[model samples]
Each structure stands twice: as C-alpha cells, then as structure tokens.
Target: MSLRWRLNLLIAGLNLGFLLVLAWLLVNNHRESIREEIEAAHRVTVQMLGTAAQTSSVFGPPDTVMVAFLQSVGRVRANEIRLIGTDGRLLFGSPPSEYKAGRTAPAWFAELMRPTLDATVIALPGARVEVVPDPSRAILDAWDRMVLIVLVGIGFVALLHTALLYALRHLLQPTEADARRLVATTRELAQNREVTRLIHAGVEDERKRLARELHDELGQSVTAIRLVAATIERGGALPVSQGAARIDAIAASMYDSVHRIVRELRPAALEQQDLRAALLDMAREWQLHHPAIEFEMHLEGDLADLGEEPTLAVFRSVQEALTNVAKHAAARQVALAVVRGDAGLDVAISDDGRAGAASLGGSGRGLGGMRERIMALGGRLEAGELPDGGFRVAIHVPMPEGAP
Candidate 1:
C-alpha cells in the first residue's frame, strides 16, 4: 500500500476504537445513573405507601383507604404500584406512563442499560402493595443520547481524517518533486554514458591511425636509412666505414623502437577482436619484460565473442592496472584473472606490493580514465588495498542483452 492509504487506515482504526470506548463508558455511566434513580424512586414510593397503610389500618379499612390513596397519587415515575387482594387478584394498578409510552429502546440496548432491582412488598390489614422498578424511560433516554453522541463522534472523526489526508498530501509534495528530479538525473547520466562511449570510439580510431602512420612512415624511413648506411660501411675507407657502421646501428635501434611503439598503440590481437588473445599476449609481454616479478594469469569461459565495446573496456582496464603495478608495485607476485559468467564478465588484478603504492585513490588520470571507460559499458571498477599490504583492482561488466 502507499504511505497515504496506510496512514489513513491507521487513523481510521484509532478513531473507531475511540468511539467504541466512548460508547462503552457512556453506557456504563448511564446504566449506573438509571440504577440509582430507579432505586431512589422505588424507595420513596414504598415508604409513602407504607406510612399511608399504617394510618388507614388505625382509622379505617386499610385496603379501601390505600387503594383510594394510590388512585389519588396516580402513576409514579420509574415505578409501578399495585394493590393485591387476599384472593390473589389485583385490586388497583398504576397507569402506564404517557411519556414515550409507545416506543422503547432496542432490546440489546435496553438489556445493556437496564438495572436490576427487587420489588418492595408492604403488608396491609387484608391486602398487600407491590412496587416494581421500571427503567424503560431512562433506557430510552440513554439510547437517544447515545445515538446523538455516535453521530457527532462519527462526524468529527471523518473531518479529522479528511484534514489529515490533506495535510499528508501537502507534506508529501516534496517527495513527488524528488521523484521527478531523480528521473531527470537518471536521463542525464544515460546521456553522459553515451557521450563517453563515443569519445572512447574516437580515441581508439585515432590510436589506430597514429599506429599506422608510425609503422608505415617512420618505420620504413628508419629501415631505408639502415640499408643506405650498410651499403656505405661495405665500400668506404676505414674511418668512413666506422662512421657508417655507427649510423647503421643507430638506424636499426630507431627502427626497433618505432615497431614497439606501433605495437603498443594497436596490438594485433585486439585488431581481431579477440579479448582472450589480447590479454594473453599482453601478459606474455609483461612477463618477458619484468621476469623478476612473478606474473600469473587465469582465463575462463569464452571471451572471444564479446562485443567490441565491452572487450575494449575490460582490456584497457587491465592494461592500465598492470602498467601501474609495474611502475609502483615493487612486489614479487602479481595475478590477473578474467572469467565470463552467465550474467557478465569478471576481472581481478592483484599484486603483493606495498599498500597505497599505485595511487588508485582517484588521484591519477589513468585510473580515472579506466573508470570512465568501464562505466560507459555499464560496468564497475574497484581498486583498493588488500588486508595483507597489497592492492587489487576488480572489474565487472554486464553482458549485453541478446548477445551470444
């Protein structure tokens, strides 16, 4: 349920409970009041009749005089007076009350409010008087009063509920505004990711072009210089031959350096879109150069078919991590692992180097760029110091939907 409805229900329940408790209290109070009133009226009626009976017995026929007196007294409030003869026949009975005579409260309500009282019997010379308590009028009064109270209580609760709902709606307006702002922010983030992806593609294209230029232009030029210098060294005088030989050696070194830079700029394996091959080749190159540091790599699942974007993201992230490790992590061991699962790709690169050596704390452009690339592919990158004085970089890239 929504917050509004839940709170509304809560308030409604509380109001209902309050109404019930109020009714209960009112019923009890009215019941007690009716009991006291009826008891008092019965006592007064009995005492007066008894006194009249004693006076009639002294001066005249007690039964006749008492009946005459009762007739004069008429119906009593909340009491019924009856004179019974020796043959068990009622000689006189009080008349029914005229106030609310035809109507009575419901049985359930009357039972709830009715008070218990015993009849008072007084002996006469040849007859008897019986006073029975009646509480119908009082019960009817309580019922009418209760009906009014309930109506009022219900109205008040309804107004309170409406007021609370209006106030809650006003208070929750900010939450709706926040929801709108969140949606806008999410759209902006998606746009930013698209921009980052485009930038990455442009960067890769530029790298490919630079690598081609260096390999074709600079590399061929250096090779041609080496050929010309070799020719001069074979035919010139001893001093001239020595100079040509030096030039040929320098040209050869330049050629080799150009080829290395070309390879670094655009690896052949990446050109084939084979992430596994690229990672293996890069690890082999690192192991060859840094033989003193033990380099370990573990590969799992098929990584050759990943789309170009995610493949590049994972490869560059690992490449930057390894570069950092070599430059700062003066450790004896490094491990790199990549796994393709049902849901996505996972990569972990760890080095048993001094903690805090690689500056993975968002201070370096290398790590920041890596994060951008990974995030563009809807992936995450985490770099932190291990518990045992080492650093680890973990990356996760979700598999694109509907891809094999």
Candidate 2:
C-alpha cells in the first residue's frame, strides 16, 4: 500500500476503535447513574409518606378518627395505600400495587436497566410498606441526553476525519511537485549530454582531417626540397656542395619533425579502422612504449550500432584515461574493458597507481576535459581509488533506443 493509504487506515482504525470503546463505557455508566437516581427518589418519597401517616395518627383522635385518617392517607397518595386491621382482614385501602400508563423509554432500554433495579421494604406507622424503584422515567431522559451527545461526537469525528484527509493531501502536494521537477531536470541533462557528445565527435574529426592534410601537403614539399638539395650537392663545387649539404640537413630535420607532429595530432589506428580495432591498436602501442606495464584489453558485445561520433567519444575518453594512467599513476598493471549492453556502453580503466588517496580526474586539465567530453555525449564518468591501492575510472554512454 501507499504511504497515504497506510497512514489513513492506521489513524482511522485507531480512532474508530477508541470511540467504540469510549461509547461502550459511557452507555454502561449512564445506565448505572439512572438506576441510582431512581433508587434515591423512591427512598425520599416513601420516607415522606411514612412521616405523614405517623404525625397524623399521633396527634389527631380515637380509633374511628384513625380509620378515617388512614383512608385519607390512601386517597392522598393516589397510587396504592394499604391499612391492615389487627385481624388482617378489613383494611383502609387496597394492596400496594400501581399501574403505569405507558413505557417511559423504549422497551429494550427498560429491559437493559431492569436487572440492576433495587427493591427496598420499610416498616411503616401501622403496616408493612415496600417500594420497588422503577427507573423508566430516568432511563428515557438519560437515553435522550446520551443520543444527543453521541450524535454530536459522531459529527465532530466526521468533520475531523475530513479535515485530516484534506491536510494530508495538502502535505503531499509539494512532494508531487518535486517529483515532476526532478523528471524535467533529468530530461534537460540528457539533452545537454547528447549535444556535448556530438560536439566532441566533430572536434575529433577536425583533428584527424587537419593531421592528414598537414602530413600529405607539408611532408611532400619538404621531401622534394631534400631531393633537390641532394642533387645540387653532387654536381656543385666544394663550397657549393657544403651549402647544399646544409640545406639538405635542414630539410631532413624539418621532415622528421613534421612526421612526429602528425602522429601526435591523430593516431593512425583511429583514423583508419573501426573503434574496437583502433582501441586495440592504441593499447598495443601504449604497451610497446611502456613494456613494464601489463595492459589487458577485453571487449564484449557488438559496437556496430554506435555512430562515428559516439565511437570517437568513447575512444578518446579511453585514450585519455590510459595516457593519464601512464603519466601519473606509476602503476605496473592496467585493466581496460568495454562491455556493450542494450542500453549503452560501459568502459572501465583500472590501475594500481594510487599511493595514498584515490581521486577522479587525476591532477591535470586532461582528466577534466575527458570528463566533460564523456558527459557531453550523454555519458557518465566516475573514478575512485580501490581499497587495495588502485584507481579505477568508469564511463557509461547511453545508446539510442532499439539500436542493434
């Protein structure tokens, strides 16, 4: 269940349970109170009747007058009054039983309170008197008050529930907004990454094209100048030959410098082959230059779906990472692996190079640029030091959907 549903259910269930328990206690308590009131009222009324009869009999007259007075007492009470003679045969009034008009409360309510009614018998002036407290009147009043109180309580609880639900919805509104904002931000980042990737790829193409042009145009001119100088030196006088030799030496040096510049500008492997082949060749070239380092090259899955720009981005990122490792890491072994997946490509370059703390991007502009380049291509770059004293760089570039 969602948090909203769970919390609402929990709070609602607890409230309902507590209210039910409270109502149960209240009803029972009200029943007991009404019974007590009836009992107290009966005691007071019976005492008054006894007082009236005793005071009248002592102060008034003889037996004949006493009989008349007893009859008067029975008439005044109007319910039941008994005057038993000495023989227990002739009496001033009927037995003490009263008839009620109708039910004061519902029959069920009366029944519920009947079990707890108290029966009290008392000695009277001239006879035995008994009073059984009937709580019908009080029960009716108590039920009315209780019903009103319960109704008000129920209404209050309903209102409170409604308010709480509203408040809960209001509280979650900001969370909903935050979720929407996060989605938009993520979309913007992806777009920015794609733009950066394309830009970096274009830059690579320019670099390769410039290198090829310089190598073809400037290299041929220098070589031709050297040939001309060599031809003049073989045919001229001793002084002329010495001057020709100087020109030839200058031309040869220029040619060698230009060749080195071209190689530095663009690797032949990348310009001439597929990304995987280019990376393997580059790895071999690095290993050849630093024979002390053990370089492992592992490739998995297909790279045919990746366009030229994405290909260039990945290759350059790997190339820069390797260069940084060779220049700064001071490590003996390097592990480089590329795995293509349905979503994207993953490249990991790890080396046992960190002397103390592991850090990302190394300590130069080169590492920073590599990170930017990768990110611009809608990829991520992460680097850290391993626990066993090594640094690892990881790159992930998201591929387009449904690419083979």
Candidate 3:
C-alpha cells in the first residue's frame, strides 16, 4: 500500500487496541459498581424484613399494621420477593417459587447468562430470597461506544498528517527547480566566455603570422626586382650618366626600406631555431639600430623545455617590451633576466629609459595581452616604473610537469 494508507492504518490499529483495553477495564469497573449497589440494596431490604419479624415476635405476631409495612417495603426496595416454608414449599409472592437444598438452577436461567452471572441470597422469617442478573452486558455496551470514538479520532489525525507531508513536498519542489535552472545558466555563461577568449587569441595569432609572411617573403622579392631594374638602367656602369646614377640611388633607398619593413613584420631569427639564440640575435640587431642604447641580458634556464604556448608568450612579451622601450624610453641602458624556477619559468625586463610607466604603452596593448596570457597559464604579471626613471615588466608562469 501507499505510505499514506500504511500510516493511517498503523495509527488506527494502535489507537483501536489501546482504547479497546481501556474501554474493557472501564466497563468492567462500572458493571462491578452496579452489581455492588444492587447487592447492598438487597441486603438492606432483607435486614429491614428481619427487623420487622423481630418486632412482631416481641408483640406476639404482627397485626394489620406490620403486614402493611412489610408489603410496602417488598414493593419499593427489593428486586425479588419470596416466602418459603421450612419444607421448601412456596408461601406467598409474585410467581411463587421454591428450591430445595443442593438443587441445580433451571436451564433457562443458566442459558440467559451466557458469560457472567451473579447471585445473592438473603434469609427472612422462614423464607429466602435470591437475586440473579448478568453484569458483563452493560460493560460490552460501553466498550462499543469507546471503539467508535477511537476510530473517529484516528481518522482525523491521519488526514492532518497527510496534509502536512503534501505541503512540505510542494514547498521543496519550487526551490529544487530554481536551483537546477541557476546551475544550468551559470554553466552556459562560463562556456560562452571561454569560447570567446579562445577565438580572440586564435585570430590575433593568425594575423601576426600572415603579416610576417607578407613582409619577409614578398617584400624581399620586390626589393630584388627593383635592384635588377636599376642594374639594367645603369647599362653596365654608364660613364657620366646622371639618370643611371639617380636610378641606382633610388634602388638602394628602396632596398633599405624593404629591409626595415621585413624586420618590423617578423623577427626572422625567432622562427629560425632555438629561442635562446634567436633572442640573442634580436639583442644584436637592436644594438645595431640604436648604438646609443646599452643592452644587458642574463639567460639561465632550459629554454628548450618550455611548452609551445609558454615559449611563444615569453618571446612575444619580451619583444613588445623592447619595442616600447625603443619607441618611447630614451634611457641608455636596458636589462633582461630569464630563469627557470622549481615549477615554472620567470622573466624580468627593465629599461633605464627616460620614459617610465607613463610611456610604456606607446604602440601595442603590451601589458594587457601579457596579463591575459599569463593568467591563462595560472601565472602572474607585474609592471611598474623603476626608481631610476624607466619601466619594468615581470612575469611568472607555472609550467607543466617535466618542463624546464
């Protein structure tokens, strides 16, 4: 059966059993009290009749007055009135009856009392009286009433209990539904943000690759074609020809412009081979461009062991920092430090240039990009102006296990 039915039945059964026992006890006690009262009344009537007999003997047998008083008492105070002779013969009473000593009661009276029967006997002057009735019948009637009341009370309690459980379930349903909806919405938003970030990073990386290829490969081809044209116009070193000389000068200027453009587009040495060697080459190239600027670098780490993403991020951040220094900072000295920690790698770039934190962002979104990259790898980035009038950028990245 369902829980509700089971609960109701259980409570009803318990209450029924308890009430049945209590009702039986109460009914038994009440019946016993009625029986005792009846017996006491019978005894009082017998005593009064015995007293009247004694008074009649003192006066040598009662006259009309004593007979009238005895008849009145028998009618009002006794449930059974009997007069019997010493030989067991009926004397006078309604339904005159007699019983000899050691005789069985009639079958009809025995059958009338199926369960409990009581009998009380009293003696009169040369007569006897007997009272008989079943007391358990009254107890059974009281027991029936108690059983009805118990069933009604148990039914009411069951209804109330069912209503309480239903209300509690209803209250929980809405809260559970709201919690599930909130979790789903939060998950969707997080996925959307992650996808957006990945797309932006991929787009920027592809654009940089294309710009490098355009400047390095195609620009060189154009420069070579211009030089060839100049050679053709010179006609094998024409003597005293200003036109040929001017064309050669123009071709030379164009070559220089092509070289500058290629370098701006891509650091070719960076893609050539080992990143450490590439960084060294970049430092040499920068020194060539700005002879007045001093460069100091300390690289002590297993640079070959860094993951592809981390390696590229470090290279790009360093390149951007140097570019900022060249474009804005007028200081003469620059320092770069790279190290491999226990779990990852660290880099610090400092410049002793006139332009400090205030001038670090002359061109690129240098620090912002660096921050995003470092955060992606569970790392940290810091940038500030140095005390000696320049800028500093520091980065720490937690690397993969077995990484240098």
Q: Give the number of the best model, judged by TM-score.
A: 1
Residues 147-260 of candidate 1: C-alpha lDDT, one tens digit per residue: 999999999989998999899988977786799999999999996886676567657866786778777767766776766666676775446656667677767777776766
Please identify which of the two predictions, 1 or 2, would achieve the higher lDDT against the true structure. 1
How many pairs of residues collide in each model?
0, 3, 2
User: Candidate 2 overall Cα lDDT vs. reference?
Assistant: 0.70
Query: Candidate 1 vs candidate 2: which has greater TM-score?
Result: 1
Residues 193-230, model 3: lDDT tens digits: 86566558657965896787667756765676666567
- TM-score per candidate, in order? 0.54, 0.41, 0.44
Ranking by lDDT: 1, 2, 3
lDDT of each: 0.85, 0.70, 0.64
Estimate, for each residue in 1-404, the C-alpha lDDT of model 2 and write its tens digit: 99889878976887688679867887789877876676666667567656655665567533344456555554322223444444564445533424344536677766875536455444444454444565655666677777787888788877888788889988876686798999999998996776566557657866786777776767776776666666676775446656667667767777766765555456665564367777777787788778999888899988654777678878888877888788778998999999998779999999988644534544434555666777778888887777798778899999888766
Candidate 3 residue pairs in backbone clash? 331-353, 331-354
Ranking by TM-score: 1, 3, 2
Per-candidate RMSD, Å: 15.3, 15.2, 13.7
